[model samples]
Target: MSVAKIALVGCGPPSRRWHGPTLTELSKRGAIEFVALCDLDETLAAQCGEAYGVPHFTSVDEMLDRHPEIMAVDIVTGDPSHHVLAKAIAERGKHVMVEKPMAITLAGCDVIIDACQRNGVHFEVAENYFRMPKQRAVIDLIEKGILGDIVRVRYVDAKAQRPFEQTARIRGLTRPFSKFGNSSGMCMDMGSHRLSQLRLFAQSEPIQISATVKRYRHSDEFISEDWAHATIEFESGAVGLYETSRLGESLAHYQITGTQGGICDHQWSHPAIPLRLQMGEEWKDVPIEFERHKVDGVDVLSRIVVHTDPQIVYVNPFREYAIDDWCVGHAAEIMSLADAALNKKEPEYGLGGRKDVEMAMAIYESSLNGSMPVKLPIAETTSYERILHEDYEARFGRPIDAK
Candidate 1:
């Protein structure tokens, strides 16, 4: 079988968290060649290249010059440099998989997306929460009428701050390209994941978003928010309350309430809440089990079963191993890209769609603007174009139009 040749930019900790493991699995499956690795830290880049047995470069141009056959670039770089690297990849006619929070500012994201679109290059946002096996199951259940009508949703992401902070410091100091615009903070950082998940699970774009952030902890270099909370009103009138914090000891929870039943994931387990149905005035839980299966050669025990009843139940078990939750979606993202590359099909969430960028930018704007409700229009083309002009003016001291 012929494997696709790919390049990976920004070999930071996130690479370790998801991309590294996935690449290892992909290489073993003969799905990818990992053509080159690039990072600002030459030592670290060399170390990682040595460990992974792939070529390393301190500059993207050098890497591309060495391997022009690279089909796709996995951009694991931080926000600030995302636009430049992604634009470069797209200019080369290679597919790009960018990390979430898309770009630091709403404007930079627009330019990046526009360049990719004009070049007919594939761009994919690495928003992995929506791809978790169990999360997919819940979405399926909701679609299949097991949940009846979803009324409300609550999501919590509380995690240890040490790793996040330390990693951020390392990458920020070593990689100038990783910096985003000064107007961004944590809401634009981690909140993108939660908001993306909400949109995916609800199967609808939020009509209005109201959010706020608090920096209870002190960090001198970064003025970013460390905690964020928001209310998203979806088109279906299903309201979702979401919160994310970098200070919590270990509180990762989510719940969604519906007319017929609700689901919750308080224990950090997949199939977090496999199936639930309204039994009388009270909600009854329907248990679904799974058998063992190999996910990328790693043993994953997942169950997909349906419980037939006056209330039909469908369950899809989540996969588990040593990697982070994001890996679950990474698999889907790669497969989608492969299909698009090999089969001449457009992959899901091609490049940076207006809707995805709107979803991400709205959360940042809503949070920074005192949780003001921001309405999303059916067409957000103006939003993207305006942001691009604004960013250009800020940097160049003149409108891009003036030039």
Candidate 2:
């Protein structure tokens, strides 16, 4: 098979650490022919392009005009730039792979997805949590029915100084990008991962959602919400309680209880040991190894399943190819998108990113609405709760998110 030609936009922190390493690994393995690196910052673009032995351009339009051979693009730009760049690429009849939260708003996501469909181009969202080998194992156990009917799902991710730094990333208060105009901040950015994990594990559509967004007092003027506590009720009648940052010490834990038994994992973000599984009254400490796999001389991390038991399965991002601490499964996710565009294999998240954004947006809507449970198929286009924006404007005497 001929190597697929790929291009990258945004040579910032995320691309440099998360997506860039994976794309480089793909080029090394001959799975992709990375054509060019594009960014608004000419210096950064040239630096990244030179590192990979590829050409770099400050403008995406100039690069595209010069290289018609580029078959796909990975948009690593900020939330505001996603729709614009994706639309431009889709217009040229090329597949697009965008970072999560797809776009800041449901309307933006709609436009991007619609354009991809209109242009007959593959549009894939980069969401890596559920793709992690350990998380995939939980999915397999749930599917095998050994865990019986899922009764309740509880997940927590707490951290100290989270609101401080993450808000910087969202409001563009830091380097790489600035003031992204995402007023929802941590509740939407990191909250999306929590919701996606719940949604994937439930294997059912969210029927109702209610949340309490921790306030700006815990954060600075840069962001509005510091954390989020959300509950989602699935169509399968299962409940998910997701407790995010609470302005405290760093901590992460997950547990799923079913009719028969339960399981828990302390290390959900990165590779760790002692993934406890229960089928009876006692806990079974099942050892899980994080490693790479091959299918007939082909590196197929997406196809390789981690066996949780005699009949249970899971998948972790390959450790052999990881470039960053948080990006263990990034390359695997990238490869999945490549398959969707080049090999006719559908991406697991395909367009579900729109739904993820919708759900994340709903959390803010719920919090400002007295934590009233918002149902799925949310009708709002703007991301944050209207009340929160009103509060911010009243406090600062100016509109924070004037996008």
Q: Could you say which candidate leads in TM-score? A: 2
TM values, all candidates: 0.80, 0.82
Q: Model 2, range 1-403, lDDT digits (tens) per residue?
A: 7867888999988898767767887687677778888989988998898887889999888889999998889888876667778988999988888887787667677778788889988888887777665566667767777567888888787645543444333221111112455323665567667778788777778888898765534233444455678888999999999887746566678887877656777877545534455646776665555554553454434323334556343433453442443454576667776776687677668678877877877777777667888988886543353444455457546543332
Model 2 TM-score (2 dp): 0.82
| Deviation from native of the Cα of residue 207 in model 1, angstroms | 1.0
Cα lDDT tens digits, model 1, 1-403, are 6666777888788886677667655665566677778888999899888877889999988899889888888888866567777887788888887777677655566667787788887777777666666666677777776677788887887744543443332111111112235224554555666666677667666898776655554456544556667788999988888787776465688787777877777864454454567888876778765455665576564555545354333322235443334465776676566655555567676533345556656655565455678787534433424554565567656543231
Q: Cα miss at 16, model 1 (Å)?
A: 2.2
- What are the Cα lDDT values of the candidates? 0.65, 0.70
Error of 1 at 223 (Å): 1.9
